[model samples]
Structures are given as structure tokens and as C-alpha cells.
Target: VLPHDPSMRPVWMMRIGLFLYDHLARREVLPASATVDLRHGEIGQPLKPRYSKGFAYSDGWVDDARLVVLNAVDARERGAEVLTRWRCADAQRAASGWQVTLQGPGGQERSVQAKVLVNAAGPWAAQFLREHAHIQDSKTLRLVKGSHIVVRKLFDHQTAYVLQSPDRRIIFVIPYEGEFTLIGTTDVEHNGPVGQARIAADEIAYLCEQASRYMRQTVTPADVVWSYSGVRPLLEDEAANPAAVTRDYQLELDTRAAPLLTVWGGKMTTFRKLAEEAADMLAAPLGGSRGAWTQDAFLPGGDLSGWIGTAQRPDGDFQRFEQALTLRHPELSEPMARRWARAYGSRVELLLRDGLGEVVAPGLYEAELRYLHEHEWARTADDVLWRR
Candidate 1:
């Protein structure tokens, strides 16, 4: 976090917060937060000269789309029926369970019964209950649209910057996709259809303005190569400021008749914990084990013990695995091998077991495309391009 001024109050407050965060848990991989002189280092090169000092902290980022795909794959491997391009047309509570009518592509419909129904439809959670299940929920969701703009790479270094705007909102300037920089996120109230959520002109200008405040190279709307927006279904907490709204989630389990669990709000950081708690809540009604098991289990392709000689840390294991893969497949280039390793991890073997048939696109092969189609439910070119 960077201080707008040299005032002692903001710096002290930040120090206290960082101290608490550093000692909050046992951090094995990341280092503790510390003070840094931004003026004399590469970290401050991209920022204006005014940003002379800031506190350096450690955090991790995830490929959210890939994470969801992996979760679906893991669920399928565990005997769960995974469906895509399907929606619950109607759901009625029965004495036995929930009778659900799922509508699929081409106007096809199928019926299924479930002992419990989990409404994790994100922004559409409330809508699903009201329209599909015909349930009147007192609890509501505050849909906040967050927008991000990707521009040509702003900095040469890998370090990400968290710039505090004059309006008290913080914006992240992070390296993205090797060729672009990602500057984001404005929190504005969304009152439109969830599917129609798109970045507005004002949002684009706001992002550019905030990003330009810190960057030596000014950002403008014309400079934006791409922009995306999504509605966050935040639990209505009555906070006047959209940014002050809590990111915490709440689970409402209605067992009055048939079990209906509705997930109100959540962020990616707490998804696993939320899932574990949700599972525990539904276990008693569904007559399943309440024991938690995901903590130790690796997601699909995360385990590299099968290929690596030593069972070391995940980063080390992955590096060794990538080297071993490159040695085994001499035909694969350095960039292609690394990309496959990072994308599929140990599961790249499954993709390569059958020889690469054709070059579908630059750096894209038929083998990988087929793997995604068969395993990850990638149906179209857009799905493969965006999701995978």
C-alpha cells in the first residue's frame, strides 16, 4: 500500500495493519511485510516521482477461470455429474427431495431429483430462488459491478503496484499476459441484467484517471486494449459506500421442507472454506460424512510426485516436472512446454499421451484442444480461448 502523503498517521496505520497481518498466521511461503524506499529502486520506476515510499507486502494471485475448471474436473472424477450450458428451468420441493427440471441447449430438458439443492449461482442467486424455486427470500444481494481495463504493459518488472486513489479507493496495476498491464476495478452499483453487465464509459474513464495519478506514463481510455466487467453479488450490509460493503459470505439453509441452501455472497479467497462449511451443513440432511477432506487433497494436475524424483514444495516440484517434460518431449519448444506445464501441470501427460494431431492456432495444438473438449466441457472456440 502506497501513502499519498508523507503524513505519519497513514504510515503508522498501515504499519499496524501490516504487523497484524504478518503475525496473523504461520506463513511458510511468503515473507512478512516490510518498509521500502520506492524512490531508489526498480519498484518505483513506473510510478511518478511523488511516490517515494511505500510498504511492501506479499500476496498471491490465481487463475480464477482455470481454478473453476479444475474444480469441475475434480468433481467429475469423484462421480459427480458435471453439466454445462444447462440451467434449472424449474425446481419444486417434494416430500422425497427437490424435483428439478434442467433446460439445456436446443430446447432439451431433463428431470432430476436431489436430496439437497445448493444455489451458488453468484449474481443470479436471488433470481434463481424467486423465479425458479418460487421462494421469497428476505435476504437480498447488492449487485456491484467491477470493471477492469487491460492496456499495453506499463512496467517492465513483475512487481505489482497498489495505488491509493484520492477518493480512498485503491487500484491495482499488475502485469498481465506477458504483453499487457491490468488496471482495475471500479465498484459501481449495478441495476441491470447480470448477463448484460458491461464496462461503462464513465468506468473506463475513472480507471484511466486513477491509474494515471500514479503512473509516469499516463493511462487513457484510448490506450485500453480490452475491458471486462462482472457483477459481484455482495450480501446487502446497508453500507452506504459500495467499497465498504463486506466481502464476507453467508449460507442460508432452509430445511423447513426439503433442504435448500442458498449462498449469498463470497470472494474467491474464501471459496474453499465456504465449500467445506456448506458441505458440513448439508451432510446431516443428506446422510453423508461430515468429515473435511479437501485440505490435504490436491486439485487435478496439482500433484507432480508421479513425475518428479523428490516430493518437494509445489513450486520446486513443478520446475523439475517442466524440465523432465522438456527432456522427454524434445520436439516441444521452451515456451510451449512451459505454457503446457503451467496450464495443465502434471496432467499435461494426459494431453500429450496421444500425439499432437494438428496445429489449430499459433501455440495451440489439436491435442490440447481435444483434451479441453473431452475433460473440461469446452464446447466452442470462445470457451477454449477465454476459459482455458
Candidate 2:
């Protein structure tokens, strides 16, 4: 459902441009629903209503949190050194390269040499630049706190709300995790540490008050099942409004001596594009790289989209794959087959070759634990459960 007011009429141009770009980029940004009807109780009638093209909910969560694992594994397979649970302790300019020391969890330290240094540190990028790299005149970062709360399901339909508060700020009320309605967010200046961002009493109240304006029922702090907050290190724009700060990123390369590159504010949605741009800038001085080839590379278990027999009709590929997998292995239930395909993709057969098991936990499997340790380097329960 699209919510419109007099102030947001200009967004039609942006929506058109976005749809056009999505088409040109071969990405499906809108569903084929063609229109959303407010007459249906699935969607609420807004005070000043506007219309949009899509009325579908895409299951985009499976590929999100696991992406970090996929990236680390892919990098390791490509001969890139990956050190986990290690902290960068020192960085010094050297004659041939930069001298760096990493402190491991055991309090042991190791030093390495690298021709170039990259600061992809999210919230601590500026501090790391000054303290470690000693870079001067660095770009400033405005740390803004964004918070979200998940309450009992607000609506029964797939339709979500893009609500505009009286103060003209926008908050989204999207269906989340099957049983919750996710509402957010607040834009407040943050001075706390990155990891210490917390949902303040005022932030929670603000979210509840804003979302309750349009939802069928009023939401309160008592309805919140879960909540989280993060400090976004936005590129410092001297706008008095924190929400008005632009999210566009910047890539800065310092080559006065050894090469040092720092990536400023960037969004995870465009991270691969940002990385490609960063690589393009660093290619020349670093004796060039294998020209950009990551545009079509799939994550670890994302190859399910490429299964055959559904190239022309790839919409039901996941269901079809689950069916085929069930047929191949009669031992697996339909739900288990679907889970295997989703968690392992093309590696399902290999992962199941060792035989299915009696349950180890509710959704955890003994065989899966073996797979995680043998393949994904998961040593602890948190590593397997949290990172996956």
C-alpha cells in the first residue's frame, strides 16, 4: 500500500526512474500484481492515497545474514587470507609495504606485510585512520542511531506500510519473521560506541506512536517482542537534519607513500557495486587486477536460481528443486528436502550423501554440524547458529 501526502508528490519521478533502472539492470523491483487496491481489507485506505505497481512480498531474508559467511568462504577459496577473531593492533608505513600486526583471541600477536592497506571498518573507520594509519585531514563521519522494534503482527496480509509521521519522517512497518511486524526507525545523533547502540525509551515510544497512527491497532512498548539499534557512520554532511544526510558512499585513495584506501559510508544493498568501484580505482597502482568478474558470481548456496528445466519459468524453481530432491532421497521428508536445498543449494546431494539423521535439535542436525565444521570452519555453537 502506498501512502501519499502533499509533500511527497515529487517522489513519483523517483519511483519512475527507479522502476526504469530496475528494468535496465535485469532486476525485478516490482511484482506483476500491476496494482494494489485499497478497497480490500488487506490494505488500509490512507488519508491521501497514492498508488504503486507491486503488491507482493519477496522472501529476501535467506540470502541476507548468511552472505558474510559466503563472502569469507569465497575469499578463502580464491587464496585470500582470512583471519577471524583477530584484531588489528598496529599499522606502520614500510619501505616496500605496510607493516601490520594482528592480535588473536589468545593474546598472541602476529605481524604481516601488505602492499596496500584498506580500511573497511564501519563505525570506527575515522578513528582507525587517525590512530593507526595516521592519515590527516580525513573525511568526517556523522554517527546517527537508527532503531527498530518488532511487535506482534500488525496486519494479516502481505501489504506493508510506509508511514509518514507528523514531523515528516518516514517509518516502515513490514512483516517480519512470520509472526512479527517490524517497525522503525529513528534518526538521532549518536555519541555512544558502535556496539553500544541501544533502543532508548524515547526511541521506542516514538516508533510505537508513529506506527500506531496508521495501523489498525495501537502499538505500545508492551507489544514489542524484540528491538535493536545501530549507529550508522554516515558521511558528514552539514545538514541540520540527521535524516537528510545522504547515504551515497565515497572511495578515497591515499598514495603519498604506500597505498591506503578508505571506504566511507556505503549501504549493504550496493556493497558489491561499491567494491567494484573501489577495485577499479585501485587497479592502476596495484599493477591491475583480473577485470571485474564478480557481477554474476553466486553466493555459496544461491545457485538454486540457476537450476535447469525452469530457465523460462524460474519462478517455482525452489519448489521444483525441493520436489526433485525428495524424489532422489526418499528418506528426507518434504520439509527436510526443502530445508536441505535452501541451506546447501547444489551441494545438497553431497551434504546428504552421509545419510540423514535423527534430530540433534529442533532445526539443527548432527550431519549439518559435521558439515559446518568440516566445510564452514564452525567450531562453536554460536558460530554455527549465529553466523549462518
- In terms of lDDT, the best-performing candidate is 1
Q: lDDT of all predictions, in order shown?
A: 0.90, 0.75
**Residues forming the 10-long window of minimal summed lDDT in candidate 1:** 1-10
State the TM-score for model 2: 0.85
Candidates' TM-scores?
Answer: 0.96, 0.85
- Cα displacement (angstroms), candidate 2, residue 60, comes to 6.4
lDDT of 1 by residue, 290-354 (tens): 48989889899988887886676766777899999999888788989988888898898889888
lDDT of 2 by residue, 278-325 (tens): 888889768968878888786666576444353333447666777777
Query: Which residue segments of model 2 deviate by more than 4 Å?
Result: 5-29, 32-35, 44-63, 305-314, 329-343
CA lDDT of 344 in candidate 1? 92
RMSD of 1: 1.5
Among these predicted structures, which one has the highest TM-score?
Answer: 1
Q: Which stretches of candidate 1 lie over 4 Å from their true place?
A: 1-4, 7-9
